[model samples]
Target: MSLAGKVAIVTGSGRGLGLAYAQELAAQGASVIVNDVDAATAAEAVAAIEAAGGTASAVVAPVGPSATAKALVDAAFERYGRLDILVTNAGVLRDTVLWKMSDDDFDTVVDVHLRGTFTCVREAASRMREQGEGGRIICIGSPTGQRGNFGQTNYAAAKAGIVGMVRTWAMELKKAGITANAVIPVAATAMTATVPYFHAAVEAEAKGEAMPAFFRHDLGFGDAGDVAPLIAHLASDAAAGVTGQAIGVGGDRLQLWSHPEPVATAYREGGWDAAALSEEFDAIVGERLQSVGEKFPPLPEELQPPQA
Candidate 1:
């Protein structure tokens, strides 16, 4: 995936997964723009890349804000004179159940994850369209967004919203040769470590304590570097035709999932009366609700602890 002469912008590249993506892309010959909320860390990452014989520049801006996102894109164009790839990886985790979750918490998560992604993609898509050459937009997503998790209503909602954005953007930009997609990654990072339940599960396993069956299986706890390869590929010219898809990258596994399932159901040729409509709607809703419990069975005793 040599990106020689190409310019790439990676948000939250100060450390962890974003840093890994920046380094890998730079190594493949892309002039990388490292964007991060922390000026110091951003500078350090850029300096490190330069020291390693890679081309990079640091752009310090909080990506959650629209103005800042525009600034980050402008900084990339100012430095490199072109924008080829935009990776919206900057995000924060505010874990809380729906009942306990605060408005601020919900807003913050949506602002950073969903709104931030939208701002960057909006700006980048405009530039890419103007450039008249194809471009790539990659949004970082999570499994919790696909399969709901306890105590992460806000996070899950934001992530799920990202997938919707990807699909819509992909369709909207297809004619312009711009591709929009998402990468759902399961890696060990500061955000995951901050969740008490996740931290305790890892610790318990390390100490040889009794653990859940799910924990016993390899849960794809790889280093941040593990996630960079897939992102690099998606951002490359080789994947130009792939868009509007959600791909999962965890450890050595890379898989794609269908967003919605189709099923056979009753239909009415003509408009039905209120009473008939009600009966049909109830049956459809009931069938769907019952399938949920059947598909996702109850957790085992060890894994059924109270969520944080």
Candidate 2:
């Protein structure tokens, strides 16, 4: 789908998955506004796009505060005169078990990922609504958020909240014909390179070797570029009918995730109390109880990182 004449803002586009999304949107003929906290990397990203004959401008600032969000939107309008698509991809990881996680760790992750998305979407939505031509809002989520990840309490909460917000926005903005969706992506990037599970793949990539097929197909882990196409698709006109969805992509896999829905429901004549729940709760919803957390297959011997 050609995004020709479209204007997009991709946060944290200085590197990693954000950079990939920005590049792909630009390649598809959109004028991209690249946002990042690091000026040097932001400049590099803009230069890379220009070098590839794509239009891009950089807005160097951290996302979260309304000011920064507004700055990104302003930059887009100032450079491209209008906004059409927004990818809320800027994020940071503060992984820690709940008890060990500090308030700062929790707030930092929530602020950047959850609040940042909210602020940015709020600003972009205002402009799109005023423009009266509809728009696209693509939020970034994670497997940790979809299920639960050990030692990633904060990140999970933020990502899950983002999906929730997207659902709400879809309903609220439907009248304006705007689409809001969340994309859950898994890939090897700066974030995953240090994890033991991806060391072998990361090493192969660093050495200019292809990643093992098993990792890409089975584990749904691949380079950041592997996830970019989905973002572009969601930002295109073809996806106008697709909104309020939590879609997953990575490697060779593309998945449609189900929204939260009750699998079982029980009612009482006079509202069952907790004591009643003790007696009949399991029988009512026990079998329907869903599992939590991501499940991974055992790593093959050859894929294991070499023992240090």
Candidate 3:
């Protein structure tokens, strides 16, 4: 993964997972463009990279806007003469239930995550196409989008939209030699620590308590450094042939996920009327509700049963 001649731009690289990715990419010999909304933070990241014997520069611009995304991409080419990798990792959280969530809260999350990723990817893809060279586009997603969570309807929708974007872009951009992919990362970062349930879940896992199977896949409390390797690999030339994929990176778990499944339906020669449709819906709902009674599989011999 030596990216000696490549130029990588990572948005929101001032801190957290974005910073970690930028640092690791730089360490691997890529000249990095550290973009963040905060000028001081971006400058700090640039200074740190330079101090570590890596080439980097700061670009203080909000990446949520299309104009800002184009400017950021232009700045990278202006400084380094080329852009090889674009990591759309900049995002913000505005968590609230549907009823309590304001228009501003919902709009902010969608604008930052979904629209922002679109802006960056669209701009970078154009440049990559013009240059006639292959490039990588990686969007950061979350488990909340894969499996719904309380107080995160807006966040989940925005994150899930990334998967759709990646899939469509991979198809449209494949001919142009641009690879599009999404990484759903669960790491213990500033965002996760703010949620009490997430914090407790992580503590319970560390204490070796009998936790739910879902919690075993919880990525909310893992080290930020743990996520960079996957991003680096995806950004490298080695992963050129991989596209239109959604990868999950969590503690002791790295897996691929599929989209929602469609239910099977009985079809007739003539389409059913409204009354027949209603009857079918009722039967389907009743069968699904009844299926909840199925018991879990037995645990291994060494493990004791969970106490109620």
Which structure among the candidates has the greatest lDDT? 2
In the order shown, the candidates' Cα RMSDs to the true structure are: 4.3, 1.3, 5.1
On residues 205-302, what C-alpha lDDT tens digit does candidate 1 reach at each position?
Answer: 45756444453345544556668998889888899989999998765567796786655367777867888878788776665652211133444566
lDDT values, one for every candidate = 0.83, 0.93, 0.82
Best by TM-score: 2
TM-score of 2: 0.97
Q: Which residue runs does candidate 1 get wrong by more than 4 Å?
A: 194-218, 268-308
Q: Kindly indicate the candidate among 1 and 2 with the higher lDDT.
A: 2
Candidate 2 wrong stretches, greater than 4 Å: none
**Candidate 1 clash total?**
0
- The list of candidate 3 runs beyond 4 A from truth reads 198-221, 282-308
For model 3 the local lDDT of residue 58 reads 85
lDDT of 2 by residue, 203-300 (tens): 98899888899888998888889999999999999999999999999888889999988899888999999999999999999899899997778789
